[model samples]
Target: MIRLDTIKDIIVFLLAYIPPLLVFAKFWREKHKNIIVLIIITLIYLGGSIFTQNLLPFILIIFDIKFIKSAGTSYLDNKIDNTYNKTKFGRDINSVLKFDYNRFKFNGRNFSIFSALKLSAISYTVSLLISIVETILLSRLNVKLEGQEVVSWMSSMQLWRFIIIIPVMIIFAPVVEEFVFRWLFFEKIFKNRMGIYLSALISSLIFGFAHFNLRSFPILVWIGIFNCYLIDKKGYWYSVFNHFTFNFITTMALLIDKI
Candidate 1:
């Protein structure tokens, strides 16, 4: 007989796929366009995974206009920027690259790198707290923490493999994920506050689900919320830094555990 906890796990697992399914359903009328986009993203991701062991960095470079015109500026950047400008949440994409924290002020003071780093630290701490809470909840529910395939794979990799992969995890992953999930998917697409919140929920849910770690889903979603807040307030790079710092710390922890 299936235990009650197993049934709960199954329900959660099925619910995790709901966002992507909704996305497909909403775009069913534009199925051809959606399919083409998905195919291109998948190919780029796979190529990076096969060759470099990192997908997001390659995707970011390929999508950057400075690197390649057709694949970068014409196809991805233009579409994302155009949509961004038309939305209420829109800001100049160029500003994101400029690192001008002065554009954002808090408590009558201009935002600085120090404050940004502080925010990143706070976000990381909050994510950890959320993870602890999630773990406790799962314990109470008698659900075994499942879905650690990525961690298992990482543990089995050689030193050289880690050296090659670490930079991608710290740098490329943050940049690419922020660009795709927060900038393009959330800010560029959503307009109102309600839309933004809904976008955050759905996008974060999808982000968590992508990791294939059901036990870490809530923690990932919390991180997603923190990232979305950064992008909405400051710009994409703020969230990128937050993401980078989080990944860097997590990667180090995993490395230490391996040792």
Candidate 2:
């Protein structure tokens, strides 16, 4: 029998995402409109969320597969065939967003400690700036919410939770999250102004909701939107950097207080 923890997320992921992903992939190959596909994916995510299961991860895997296929196609067409690459949505984001396999190859940029630090710095700075701006805006709206408390408390450097947390924040979180939210979803979904706004909005909302912190949901939402903008404005690198840095710094801050 599967462990409760293992089976829970695994089953949820498969049931919530596999059908829609297959449908979307087949539809994409046919060069059809992806509205229905997106809708199906969205419902799967919503269902997964409501059920509090691992469905999101499963859906993400499907999306990841699609992204990999697109990337391979893009690389081959650009390098070998000279045909313009197409996104899963049948739109080309490559004219502006270039993915250098040499630079961003799996064993290349991302695996390097230097690159990770650089990414952490950029992502943290951007996230901090966006958080500041958002704080100001929400203040003007006369709404207040909880600040980082338990995280701060548990993060005390005296406790050593931070030492463990920092690496998790930096290395573990960035790779998967960036690949899914920024690289895969943003690359596939956001094509134009409307799509851009929607992508940021939807993706951000999902990002926040995923946290499961009801009190901080709004803030997370705003952060998600800002992160999406950063991804569009700068590149996936910026988002990856900001995300790692933000998490690392916050965890450190908490750790320091504990110390």
Top model number, lDDT: 1
Per-model C-alpha RMSD: 9.3, 9.4
TM-score of each: 0.63, 0.50
lDDT of 1 by residue, 78-180 (tens): 4554453232434433323222223222122444678779999898788889878888887899989765666667778897787677877798777667756
- Model 2 spans with C-alpha error above 4 angstroms: 1-158, 190-194
Write the residue-wise lDDT of candidate 2 on 143-254 in tens digits. 8866544464454345654565466556545555655565545544453544777877876766664454555666567656666765565555566666766776666666
For candidate 2, the lDDT comes to: 0.55
Badly placed stretches (over 4 Å) of model 1 are 1-50, 53-111, 192-194
What lDDT score goes with residue 210 in model 1? 62
Q: After superposition on all CA atoms, how large is the RMSD of candidate 1?
A: 9.3
